[model samples]
Target: LAKTTQPISMDSYEGQEVNITCSHNNIATNDYITWYQQFPSQGPRFIIQGYKTKVTNEVASLFIPADRKSSTLSLPRVSLSDTAVYYCLVGDGTPSSNTGKLIFGQGTTLQVKP
Candidate 1:
C-alpha cells in the first residue's frame, strides 16, 4: 500500500490559492492519487483525482509529477468556508488497505482566515 505524508495544518487568507502537497513514497504504478475534503461534522468529499500530468475541474486542480510519487491539490480563490481537513488517498479501485478500498492519510487541516 502507498503511504502519504502531508502537513498537519495550513493557514490561508480569503481569496487566496492554497496548494496542498502529499507525498506517497510507496505508490504503485497502477495506483491512482486522489484528494478529499472534509468539514467539521461531515464526511469527506472527493476533490480531485489524477494519474499523471494535470487535471482541472470547477472546484480544484490536481497536478501529478512524472514519478507519480507526489501530488498537489490546488484550491482557487479560497474563502473562509473552504477551510477543512483534506485527505490524500492512494488506491486502485479495490479493497486494498485498512481504509476499505483506499489508503487514507491522517489529513491536513486548512484554516482560511478572512
Candidate 2:
C-alpha cells in the first residue's frame, strides 16, 4: 500500500490558481499523504493531509516538506466548476490495515480552460 505520483494533466483559466504535485518516493513508515478530488461522476473527496508542515482546509492547501517524499495540493481561485480529477494517496494508515487500498493511481486530469 505505497504508491503515489500525482498529476496527469493540468490547465487553468477561469480564475487561475492551481497547484498539484505529488511523488511518494517509496514513502513508508505508516505512510500518510492523502489528497483527492474527482468531480466527473463523483467519488474522491478528502482534500488535505500531512505529517510534516502546512495543512490548510476549507478545500485546499497541503504542503508537506520535511523529507516526507513530496506533496502539494493547493487549488485556490480556480473555477470552471473546478474541473476535476486529482488524486494522490500514499497510505493514510489504518484502512483496517491497508484494506486492499491504493486510492487510485491514475488520475489528475484538471482542464478548466475557459
Model 1, TM vs. native: 0.92
Model 1 per-residue lDDT tens digits across residues 1-114: 788999999999999999999999888767888899999999899988888999999999999999988899999999999999999998774444434367677899999999
* Predictions in order: lDDT: 0.90, 0.81
Which candidate number has the best lDDT?
A: 1
**In model 2, what lDDT does residue 25 have?**
85
After superposition, the stretches of candidate 1 with alpha carbons farther than 4 Å from their true spots are 93-100
Q: Record all residue pairs in model 1 with backbone atoms less than 3 Å apart, i.e. clashing.
A: none
TM-score of 2: 0.33
Model 2, span 30-64: residue lDDT tens: 67887878787777887777877788888789888
The collision pairs in model 2 are none
